[model samples]
Target chain A: MIWDWAFAFEILPVLARAAIVSIEATLIGFALAASLGLVLAVVRIAVPWTGWTISVLVELIRSTPLLIQIFFLYFVFPKFGVVLDAFTAGVLAIGIHYAAYCSEVYRAGFDNIHRGQWEASIALNLSSWTTFRDIIIPQAIPPIVPALGNYLVALFKETPLLSAIAVMELMQTAKIIGSDTFRYTEPMTLVGLFFLAMSLVSAVLIRSLERLLNRRTMR
Target chain B: MGIRTLVTLLIVALGVIAALATQEAYSLFLPGLLQGAVLTIEIAILGSLLAIVMGVLAALARMYGPAPLRWLATVYVEIFRGTSALVQLFWLFFVLPQFGVTLNAFLVAVLALGLNVGAYGSEVVRGAIQSVARGQWEACTALNMSRPQMLRRIILPQAFVAMIPPWGNLFIELLKSTALVSLITLSDLAFKAQQMNQNTFKTIPIFTLVLLMYLAMSLVVTIGMRLLERRASLGLARGKAA
Candidate 1:
């Protein structure tokens, strides 16, 4: 039979457990990307001395494939006495790679703020920290929430790359099922459906978030 | 001199020194890696052409075709866009044979990547086409031109300009994704790197070279797209002046 429903049902529990790993990786990686990206963006802007170096680093990361980055971290780092487990390497690689992208989104968000807003904060004799925290971040964040959400979804899709490092993510688990039973059709199809469902759910959530933020900003 | 210039020069010098120090390693790895890179470029170019064709067709179908075509196009775009490229590649590579359809690994790579990127490209195409002014459509209608005539002559030229930059981005994306083909057992660039790494256990130099090669290709794509954008906008401006 091309597809065995009974076999698919049998593998559901294992695949479900693996799916949790994938989800965990996505969330942790995104958190790292988000916070680290904001710092990278802020440093590039606030500390003029570091701007060029950060820009070059971000550009290099952005242009390369994430798989190679994972490989570099997983394989090469061990030689320099900085070994990482597969899951850690995968998460860090994805987090750092997407951080480059997320930083750009943040930079764009900051750039869109009006000059008057900054000048007003200065005229009020606000401290830099207070101005940034009170004036800049709240305004900068809302508009970029949708962009960051897109990266979240993108990062989720990237979780399968973790499988390449043998992290036993959903794709790797499915591949193991296929190899063990030689019945790939069911496992592959199931994995694909899982991804489709998760991504669609995330897309709907992001749209509503955008609407909710918009309604709040309207007031 | 500014610190930035000194830093930039220092990086360039380091890169040169690294290359000089690694000459023996380069000769050992370059032939296999270059052959893999050629295949990588081949897949990227062919996949890009397929993606452009699929993207245009799907976008037009969704926008202006009959109900069934629109429905089919929507399904195509959503399903392809929703899943990971690696899953798509594996499904095509490993599962299709169960249904009595066995494709070559190379063909499967191109098809999967093309369809996946084409899904994203469809949205870009749709947006660019929509950005063409409503008044232009009215103007075409008033002139008694057919739908295809209006789209071909008036709408597409303007839309094409906007599409180039995004299309360039998608093309680079397609190039990066070609790395996944390695997992499907095609000896693409990433596969060669991994294969070489396993043979010699020289992780640093192998991966470094591979990363630099990918970075160089992506830079070329960026510069090429920028040039296309410039030439396109110039033509439009000149046409307006005339």
Candidate 2:
């Protein structure tokens, strides 16, 4: 019941090892979400029909809870004869669920671009790809970087849900260590501390990025 | 007319058909899913109510209360907002028990969610109240209306209306966050899906059904919210028009 430094020291290394897995999942998951979200946003904007479909798909994904989605993917895919490792399944499910929200962020970014910019791009007879890459993307991305960075922090916190599917991430590793030692206090507390530390770091990093982006924009 | 549309249609059609073909399995899972749905609704409704209350209190305290009370409220908001809900949930459910304050899983889930959502909702509530025109407050003061009376008669009604859309979205987010409760052994919809998958070993169909059921629930909520928003905004529009 008391604060035990000895136990805390013992669990810190184990949890830190598991923390690496969490960091990996978060980075890969964010990368997947960012790219896929951008593609979905582009598809939705350029083609009306595609937009409608993507909207529906995004809403469907958003409406459902992520725990269910992760469960579904981890359990269901193997039945269809495509078995993924726990880590891959966890990352994929998290990536896919978050991509729906990121797509919304991207859509907002796209919408916030002034109509004049689009008209000008079209006026120059530039291809859609060139216009997006050269003008629209540069303008849209700055405002969204903060939002995307927030999602990265969000995705980091959500890595615990991977424990449910047996991914042995930080939370799962902590749970294992706790159950084995019959001492939940140290491991669980350490996990909470780890999350708190990482979240604080991410928040500070995001604020600095926002400031940097603002300075660049002002110039 | 184009290949992309055709491909999307094909994928969607296939997903739906696959969902329907496993109708019997859905029947088996429906009871559990429905139970989970009840929990989901309970969490959304009760958690939202708690959040609104906490949000209003926090906002009011920050805006008008004593300095220490304002600091307390600000600290609460920052801590909850800066942390993840999942971590908060775990700390509440798992760590709190070690302190001999063993809350039930359902209560733990509700408290964790309510507290987290309350932090976000406080901002919405605060902004909505602040955005009420300064002239309106001056008018109330000239009328010699007491502070409480002015708030009740003039400010809150308008603020509540403005808070609707963001609150609606928050309700949806609350609905989704309820799934995390399954981790603490709450038999919510997500838990049921996991159970059904374990039993049948047919993961895809059961989950597809769950996805559709969730979609149906969210769509219904969205429609209801939209109607309420329209009704609220219509009153404002009519006032403007007059």
Candidate 3:
């Protein structure tokens, strides 16, 4: 009752295939969030007029569950003449939900850029674009990378929720296997271990990246 | 129109559209949604209470206990934090019976959510406790205080201040996570909304209503937490000044 070695071995390969979908969803979703979040952060700053609306939108997204957002996009959007497959809907919901978090991280980085840098840019008669590209962005981005990396790991953990919309992600596949064979322990435990391995490896990778970014900036 | 006015207009238009879309749904399924909302709240409140307890105990063990206890705490934290709460719930619900540890659905939901959230909360607690000034620890020790007295009288109060904001954030996260319980057949808010979707096939209105309901509850939780934080910080300030 405590352990089953052969069954665990049996499920490992099955879980691995499903893990690929989980990884893809995480990567694509994170890519969407990272780029969209940067755009959102810059837009809010550059267009103060849109700040309130954007803030409201971000807050609304952050406050609600990703599950509801997925449900809304999957089911409701079609009624309004937009259609998305399960994978796309899951990716979009997760990506958008995390964009709200990423935006705050970007905003923090942007805010941390000191007033002196802006004055220096103005003194040199550097165009705003040149100033941002040359000075502000380079300084703003390094500290933000670590935070962004954390969201990547979080997005990976959240990939399981895609199972709800029938995405056949790692967790869903494991659930299916469990139901079919009535051997729940092995597959479920393997999924947890699967997540555990990825999470630890990501954490280590992010730490090293953070260290690298700090060193590069120091030079 | 000004931006505020425009934003207001947009929101009003959305409300009008929702009202129009959900005319029949409002009458028919409102109670079901409300019942679901109540269950969601119950699960969230109880789960969070258990999480805080687990977090504090784990933090305490990690910080002050000997080698094996610390290792146990660390392993618990990492495993729970690393995994998905949804997967954790499924494992508890589906897998436990195989091992002859069959609990009911509600208890499983609470345990899974509590353990998942408690892991993260333990880190928060540990970080806050460590961030308390070294001088405070030395001062208490120099006064010949025992470990328990030192922690209770000196360390915990200050550390508690730093822990509140993060705890508030975790609370909202927990609230949003309650939506996942519906997948485990918990009859929560999300489950009822799914039932509505199946029955009416009106995904638009039902899901939109559920979304708004979640938003409303989240707002309540956030505002309530802010008030709690303010009250707690005021007490902290008084303690420091005294």
Error of 1 at B239 (Å): 2.2
lDDT tens per residue, model 1, A40-106: 9988877899987898788788878999899889997789888789999999999999999999999
Weakest ten-residue segment in model 3 chain B by summed lDDT = B1-10
Cα deviation of A130, candidate 1, in Å = 2.6
On TM-score, the stronger of 1 and 3 is 1
For candidate 3, what is the lDDT?
A: 0.87
Top-lDDT candidate index: 1
Better of 2 and 3 by TM-score: 3
Highest-DockQ candidate: 1
Interface RMSD of 3: 1.0
Query: Model 1 TM-score?
Result: 0.95
**In model 1 chain A, which range of ten residues has the least summed lDDT?**
A55-64
True contacts kept of each: 0.86, 0.70, 0.92
- Model 2, chain B: what is the TM-score? 0.88
Better of 1 and 3 by DockQ: 1
- DockQ of candidate 3 is 0.83
Per-residue lDDT for A54 in model 2?
84
Report RMSD (Å) for each prediction in the order shown: 3.0, 4.2, 3.5
Off by over 4 Å in 2: B1-22, B142-146
